[model samples]
Target: MKNESIQPPRFSSALDPIPDYLTHYFERTAGPFLNICDLDDEEVQKIREFELSNDIKWSRFKMWPEFMKSRKAADDLLMRLYEEKFQKSPAHRPVFAVLGDFHEIPCLYANPGSVRIEIADLREDEVTFMYPDHAHLIQFFDHDAPAFGVPLPENYSEERMPCWGKLFTYQDLHEIHVEYGIKKAIERCLNTPGSFVFSYVEAHIWTRDLKFTPIDHEPTGKCKKA
Candidate 1:
């Protein structure tokens, strides 16, 4: 019996590319390589004050405190995990990207754009990290990870975690693919429509600087038409 009442996931598409590379999506206006935690306390306070004065309801200003806490907790855990694995600390607030081509990730932003970067593009000295899904949200809220969307497979283990409980390096990309490749990651999201969690595998690029394409903003939002 066909259950047409169960609407399919909105973002997954037959045309979504299963690319050989990764992509960093951002607001073209802001350009790429920006991290919110980079802001100093005073600067953040100024923005918070400004936003509250302007009467913006549920603004990022109001959420800054808890968000920062979550972000820092995740970042600290990532640093510890990476250092333990690689014998050195990775740079704080590395640029965020996702393995393969995922259209839904970019749509989370107000003005989305992407620049594709591949493993070959990285310098030999550069270090990178990856997780099967968004690192911060998953790592910080691990208690809710396994049951995020559909119930996880009965055999789910650390080797098959769907979120940030695990971290991988560029050297581990091949092994990662064998464990949870692009196709599987996409399918996980597709299985649960109307939920953005576990949408794609996240790749954290660590470098002092990076080269990126110019502003290529595509106006889209989950709540509004593109």
Candidate 2:
């Protein structure tokens, strides 16, 4: 008997008949998403030195500020990139989300509530997608691992490579879908193992206070609350 080829997972596209929603995960008790950069240095330092019984998936990232001046600098870079692509400043700091159901993300809290926002609800111009997370692409942010865009193995096709170190607007994604079909375009960002693992397309929502529905708590058993 012949063995069947296993197909990779399929995700909804922004242009699909039934499109995917962007998911923002957070500690339900925290209320709304808070930008740490907005906090004073003293409070930020406390978080940086926060004690936890056990290490979490992104525990090391808490030390990231040691490599940079501050978290504000990082957000400035993000805003600069956003303005470079959109030619305008965002009204508020973006609320981050993943393109679809991507539970493998290492940065998620131990027990989190998710807010799902429909793609249709967001303006195409206000949403941007970044492959393998934007921080990995920051020139100054030391990845502390292999650089992105490391050549793939001999058998891997070049077309599978994502637009590394860049952001993609909704129209850009649409153009890619037109050329390669939505499945391949989605493949370009999803499950791509490079210097970083568990990679998923990150969506940055430029507009603030868009309506979203809260979902059930997701317990990943990855870490304890710090």
Candidate 3:
């Protein structure tokens, strides 16, 4: 995994070496179980197929300014489809959504009155719909932690390794899903060793937002950004 010549599996233009810090985190924590993703892997195919099946269009945008105009366009279509097509009220709608990109991070959408139709806003870069009850969700958000694909600092603590590369809402951890022993798992990751953690923060949009570019449809020896 330390080969300097080892490129990032043809989906990204990143020539950066896979950091030793990431390797250490992987070794120290239950990194594989944390469910981080590689774009050029089979795990991503599910979301890709979902997008194609739904005819969700893809575009390249990373800035709010760049995405705003089209965000409304996508929003209009998605809102109409969701509200008029599959209209579900807050209680009837899902408690959370599992955004299926290369990574599978969950998110909270419905509240007292409205369900989030803005979800279609991410269709290009992320796809899929996974309905989660309060029983199966947890969230964390540490501003100090690194975002996905960003390198970790030298001398990073193994204790905080599980906190890296994920989003935190800081709400669901306390606000919702008080049962099903989700906190027990969260504590295991933050307190003990070799633990797996999940988050409900929409880390995907906040981390990359309009800046996220889709990787190639299939893994290859060369980069083919979508």
Best-matching candidate per TM-score = 2
Candidate order by decreasing TM-score: 2, 1, 3
> Lowest-scoring 10 consecutive residues by lDDT in candidate 1?
1-10
Clashes of each: 0, 0, 5
User: Of models 1 and 2, which has the larger lDDT?
Assistant: 2
Give the runs in model 2 whose Cα sits over 4 Å from its true position.
1-19, 49-54, 60-71, 140-162, 177-198, 218-226
List clashing residue pairs in candidate 2. none
Q: What is the lDDT of candidate 3?
A: 0.24
**Whole-model lDDT, candidate 2?**
0.56
Candidate topping lDDT: 2
lDDT of model 2 at residue 33?
58
What tens-digit string does per-residue lDDT give for candidate 3 at 183-223? 34333433232221232222222112322211222222121
lDDT by residue for model 2 (1-226), tens: 1133222124433345323667776644444456655667786565455523235455433534352353345456677778888788877777777776565442444335666777787787677876545554544344343333223234433365445546787667666644544444455644454323324467888887577766554344644445
Error of 1 at 126 (Å): 3.2
Ten consecutive residues with minimal summed lDDT in candidate 3?
A: 106-115
Write one digit per residue (lDDT tens) for candidate 1, span 1-226. 1222222123433213433455676655566776656878786566556645543323444544455555555555656766777687776656777665556665444445677565576763354545444344333346332222233345766555543355666556555555555446656665466545456666777774664433233333342333
